[model samples]
Target: MGDENRTGMTEFYFRPFSSLPKVQLLIFLILLLMYMVSVCGNGTIVLIVCTDCSLHTPMYFFLANLAAMEICYSTIIAPLTLANLTSLRKATISLAGCGIQMFFFIFLGGAGCVLLAFMAYDRYVAICHPLRYTIIMSWTVCVSIVAASLALGFLVSLNMTILIFHLPFCGTNEIYHFFCDIPAILHLLACSNTHAHQVALYICSVINVAIPFLLICFSYAFIVVTILRISSGAGWHRTFSTCSSHLMVVALMYGCSSFIYLRPSSSYSPEQGRVVSVVYTFVTPVLNPLIYSMRNKELKDALSRALGRKVLHQSK
Candidate 1:
């Protein structure tokens, strides 16, 4: 009865969440909380950076950009994922819709990586050459860096998305992973001899993943060496404190990215890939504002003062 034969029928099967039994429910709840947290948390960061006169430095400037990108990045994929968990329908997306999602996801994600690298270079100049920090990280240079990052992000993501979307997805429409990542889409293609597509994937990996990671790595390496050379213990602590939060963010972002995208696509099992994708895509954005706001004294004091003023006005 279950195996009734039909003519020219394409049986669509949804990937089941039953694969991850114990932790599936827990992860879903946490991700829902994260979506709200990242939205509100990053929004507050942007507001404080904009309003506070004293906080208008190179670090906060970059922080504002990072927060903005986190909002964009999380918005692209997290809502759909949460819907898939909560609703009855396993929310199907059309090919065009999937392409649009991939574009913003990659674009904002790429931009975030670039800005983080720039932030590291900012710390490097600030600590290693305090005398020249202001001149080096001038207003013009900061604007240029942010602009270049956004430009490169859009260009690279546009190319990759266009190339991947052009491939005919005639065979199967079901993507195994939770969201519309390139590697996840590749798995659904019915075409044989995908050599050309694989080549494009490799090229994108080099540009979007490999190169930016190397830049981040080199920036931190320089930062560490400079921190070590500081003569006094107090001076060393002061220097390390400045960049430690950024370093934590860098670690989590890069670690999750490497797990999801750096490995051979053949190695990612469907269920495992979805789980790992949740880490970098959903989890990392939620962590960004908390890492910076909690650890950085300036942001905390600014936020507290802003809230206290509001409370006072309300009482009056």
Candidate 2:
């Protein structure tokens, strides 16, 4: 019905949230503050990782890449959202721009999800097979894993974006939420039967979100078993502390993402979706990098040394 009607319809408008100007301004400020925090937090991690030779381990390497991804991931969605919040009623994104946003949104997001699982595996190997940790997680293997994760993420995002924009948008051009979310577009906006599209989305979500989460869980199961066998007394806390940061990140990423993507579009509530999207998009990106670098003693020590060196350079 909408194929021809949608041919020239190359723009999508974002609907306003709060009718009150004060409320909109408040939201904008808060979002901007959080976005800045996310950028600095992730940016610090990247800087320290690259500068500090002590943090050149595989885990920190992955952490640096993950931080870089968060910085980019949030930038992809947050600025546009902040702008929308300020304007309140009149914000429009071109069709191509929207598709590009969706592509990187999924690419970085899916890659980050998979990278978490790999980090879990790194913990697993270091704990379960301590003697072979070096061999098992070789630099070559880590780089390859990261490369594969990105390639796979890119391919999946490309396919999803193409399928989505290919649909006819002959009807309402108003998006109910901040960005071009898959369900928001597929269910509410696309003027076509989305049975096949929904199925594809569901399958990808399972592969990207569910499967990686399960893998993390599986790896952690072995990690717990191995930790219990080797440590007791005060050793228990010390042994588990290394993984606690990662586990928290896993919980946050999977919990919010699953809530957002792991369901049928028929049950998608626009209000609820926007609220939850804030968590994974804004909150997690801020917290994940902080927890990894800020909370880790080794990274902290490295940062201290870097600061010491910086101060010495300035003094000299």
lDDT winner: 2
Model 1 lDDT, full chain set: 0.79
lDDT of 1 by residue, 262-307 (tens): 7776786777777787778777888888999878988999999999
Query: Can you write out model 2's per-residue Cα lDDT over 18-72, one digit (the tens) per residue?
Result: 7788888898888898899999989988999999888888989889999999999
- C-alpha lDDT of all candidate models, in order: 0.79, 0.87
Colliding residue pairs in candidate 2: none
- Judge candidate 1 at residue 162 and give its lDDT: 80
Give the poorly placed runs of model 1, Cα more than 4 Å off: 1-16, 19-28
True-vs-predicted CA distance for residue 139, candidate 2, Å: 0.6
Stretches of candidate 2 above 4 Å error? 1-6, 232-234
Clashing pairs in 1: none
